[model samples]
Target: MNGGTSTTTATPNPSTTAPSAPKTSKPGRTSPPNSNSPPATATAPSSASTPTPPTASARSGGRTEHAVSPRLPHGASYTLLALGAALAAAALSFTALAAQFDNNVYDWLFRVHPAGHRPHEAVLLAFDDRTLMDHGGVRGLRRTLASTLEILAAAPPRVTAVDLTLADPGDPAEDARLAAAMLRLPGLALAAEMLPDSSGWQDPRPEFLAAAEAIGHVHALPGPLDEINRMIALERAAGRDRRFALALEAHRLALGGGAIVSTPSDLESGGVRIPSRQDAGRPLRVHYRPSSTVETLPIGALLADPARARALRGRVVFIGVTALSAIPDRLFTPLSPLDGNRPMAGVEIHAQSFETITNRSFIVDAPPIIPVALAFALAAALAAAFTFTSAPVAYSLGLVLLVAAHTLPWLAFLGRLVLPPFAPVAASWSALAACAAFRFFYVRRQLASSEQTTARYQQAFHFVAHEMRTPLTAIQGSSEIISRYNLPEDKRKQMGQMINAESKRLAQMITTFLDVERLSAGQMDLRSSSFPVSGLLDACLRRAQPLADRKHISLEATAADDLAATADRELLEYALYNLLTNAIKYSPEHTTVRVSATRDAHHHLLAVTDQGMGMTPEEVKNLGRKFYRTERAERAGIQGTGIGLSIVRQIVDLHGGRLSVESAPDQGSTFTIALPA
Candidate 1:
């Protein structure tokens, strides 16, 4: 009867022990324990029982607690960067840098593809050097003109346009001779020039003007960038007086002499449409025929053989100086070799302009919005490329986009549409580079974060195995001894108490570890309340007094009773306790550990000072990193997992506090936690 009572009292309750029995039991076996049961079962009935599995509601709540908040997708950053790059390029397009590039490209297109298969509607009667020499060095200009007109009247050209300005009066007898020669032509047009002041036109003398049918302005403006002649202004105006270009006047006379009907965008002369916009000063892009293809007759050639006048029959004649030294009217064309090495005579350029008007071959400029639209399109393509595709494939597609930007302008030019080459190319390159750099850095950051998380998890496992081993072993051993023997009541009670104490310690460790992790991840909600700082410090000192006594160390704490802090009391208590224990554990025997709390202007400062084997400045800086310990502690054989300070730092951070340390080698360390008042 005595043995039965002892066994009943010492044995674990059947209801509590029954659940854990299956953990060691083999599957599909329901027999009671036998002599053959493994030794592990003997220690399984401990106070540290495994926790029950959570229910469905508990698991669902856990997921809800840890779910991440919505944020902007990673691709959005890349897309925004691409847009910025493209917009910068578009803004730069309106500057002179882009226009210069466009001009160069326009010239390249003309040089590569000259006009083909055009009717010769105009002729150039060049006054070469030989013509000037034969006419006595420009002094006999009136005699030369009278002789050339006599030969031209026999064949009778449709219209004769003189490019030389007769605005000033020459010798009266010579001027009258030239005026009579001009009246004998079937059709005559005299050249006028704009005065230097731009106030009025320099018209021919009254006698010369009376013999001519029309007077046109002889002005050929050069390109702003390189002084190359790519286009001509068809109309010039001074106040209310306006005059058509020399080429236009000749075309009008050749088409049987009718009034030129004008609109803002174009001109209509005798049924021919000319694309000359008024807003742009009636600009016309000339389609230059090759110099070799133009029908040119020097004045000396006509005088040497009268038969050469047949070539001028029924064709509008442009008479001007072709000798390079005779006139400064020479200008560069797109077809000029080496940019400006072979300049074309002004008379030939006018003949080409007339041919362009007659042949109806025009190169039209694209609208201003077209380049901007293309830039945006290129940016969008590059953004999508980096967003949805891998790096290698995205870069390959980017290369292709760059090539398309360069080639599109030339292709458009072939179709008779002029597109600027700068905006699309600049935008595409800038966007590609920007997107690639962003993706590169973003991927590197994500990889670094992943590596850090993996390392932290590995450290956590080490901490769990190291810190919980002693308590788990004590609980298991105590349970084994209590379960294997029949003993006195006092002895059984003692073993049971040991198991209970170690099991509670293990549970506390787990709870503290979980709290620290939750707080660091921003998943734990702090419980805020006002508590006296002195009361909190006193409680932590009491808890750490035993450890200090074991090492023969004294603890000194100072706090004002009236001082208080608004924070999570439980978490703050844990933090203060951790600091106290660390101070006591690291201090030398008979040394003192100090704990103090005080309030400043805006914060509650809690400090811990220890006289241990002190730390270097570098070690103090690294104090709060998990599993990081100083060399002094390791050499002193101190028993620690190095996770205590990390937990303390995390807890204080949750209360909107900062942790600071002041220390040096061989000097005691002071750690301070400053909480917002």
Candidate 2:
């Protein structure tokens, strides 16, 4: 109704998808036959042009000629339309930009991020050469104790979260300096060291806990199975109390909570129940910044460096050390550079988690039902539109549909559209494209069939014409020789024999040609009647006797006494005759050519095996093509029309049988016809 996107709603028939009404068109359509006078119909095929269409009907219902099993009921169009609309709607809804994005499947969408954009307030604690040279090396804090409290007071930030651990409680002044910093910053939180409670002892640092406004157990986020970080959990226990996770707490602190958050009964349903979180979540989707190489900044640079430090004022600063000390617990984020090294501390990861929660952006997957409906609708629409058009246009439309399906995922990349990339769109487009290709090629084949029929007729005509010339010329020459000159009795008899031989060759050639023509036209109607199987071999053996005698080749028949099959008599006879003739023709002089028919409990087989100058597989392959002779045979000067076995195959097929040949150069071929007994 609205530019091909309908808005009508109907209750889905839960029982079935097949719609009901008067038939309109089939699932896939084909055109009616061609337009020629006399009009081709299944009945009276020969007299009524075989390749032509019937006169158009007066129904005047805008019908197109198509070859399909059956038509879809006209009433079902609304159902098809409804399904299509639903698909389009679902794609738009879950795919939109402002929708709740799932951080879980983000790396699936984006694999590599360039230099990320960091706009959040975060501080860096650089272990400078000055601090290192003051003491010794890695553990330089043992000497001169500097107060972090002074640093926190100087930089005005909403939150002061430290990443370091006071592993050694012996340095009382150093511990005191950190504690003093916690009291000065009202929103300051310390990353607490986790002690395994296996011994049932709680080692709580009262002074540090008392000074800090909030204490978060320092724990890192898990990376993807492939070491990629796409998501962070926002809801978790801070410590003993069921308090908000550090990220959640940070977000709540920034947005100013309306009510203490409570667990809903549906926390398992992947929904976060936080009060007045709209603002905090709106700005947390930060572009990432790599912490190594060019992205590295010393602690002094964050505090003393003007450009970045100016940007950090009034924003909450979460300070943490970026080190790869996995002998201890680490902040295992997805985007670390040290060969998939997990983030070492949880404090900085909490900053990332807070940033994501505040931004309120996530990825969403469209419903499964949407794409399924989409594919069916797309396939149906393409089939409908091209049902009446020429092949080229239908093919072009198919390609367009294919391209459209391929381009679908790009919407998610550029404009945040989560369309189906796997089953429905891809699968349906492929099906449509296949339909288009098959239909187009099938029509072209039918046209070619008509032309081939004409060509076959032309070739048969010339074959007959050429055969007549040989015998007619011989007869004329023989008569002239008799009339124009005196000849001895023996010489006259020889000339008569010459004329007789050519005439006989002409007859066999003509009969064979006619036999094939009838078979090709599909007019050689068979009269199915049960017959004695050995009767067939017995008949062909007698027919092949003369040809065998000419080369002194033995034509032998061996068969089990009784085998039965219900099939046409003449068709079977023709097939066996061709096999016998080839055996005699290809075998060398005096070679035995065996003709046998046997029946096992399951099936009956008719086999012809020849011994002599056997053929290569290439020769056997060309044996069925009209006018095609094997190169070796032509060189050997064997002569006959080339379509004998082609006719044989047609006859075998009519009997629901298979014909197989086995041969190699110099090894005789065994041709076997297998059929149900």
Which candidate has the top score in lDDT?
Answer: 1
Q: Please give the TM-score that candidate 2 achieves against the real structure.
A: 0.47
The global C-alpha lDDT for each of the candidates, from Candidate 1 onward, is 0.78, 0.54
Model 1 residue 120 CA deviation in Å: 2.9
- Candidate 2 yields a Cα-based lDDT of 0.54
Regions more than 4 Å wrong, model 2: 1-119, 122-146, 150-156, 166-168, 172-181, 193-204, 221-245, 257-287, 290-314, 322-352, 361-465, 468-527, 531-565, 573-646, 656-676
* Pairs in clash, predicted candidate 1: none
Tell me the deviation in Å of residue 433 in model 2: 16
What are the per-model numbers of colliding residue pairs? Answer: 0, 24
Candidate 2 lDDT over 456-522, as tens digits, reads: 7787677678656655655565656545555668757756666565566665566667657656656
Candidate 1 residues 1-677, lDDT tens each?
13211110111222332222222222223334345653222122332222211122333323333534437675787789888988999999998999999989998898888788777888889898999988876777767887898889899899999988788878888888888888889779888888898999999999988889988887888888888898888899976799998889998999999999999999988799987789888888888867888888889989999998987789899998888888888889888874346788887888888888888887878887998899989999999988898889999999999899998999999887789988898999999999988888988998998899899888888788876776676566556645665556875776566667667767656765665566567665565889888788777766666556556667777777677899877668877777777876777777888887877999999998988777887898899997788988888877666767887787777788999988876678788999999
**How many angstroms is residue 636 displaced in model 1 relative to the true structure, after the best TM-score fit?**
4.1
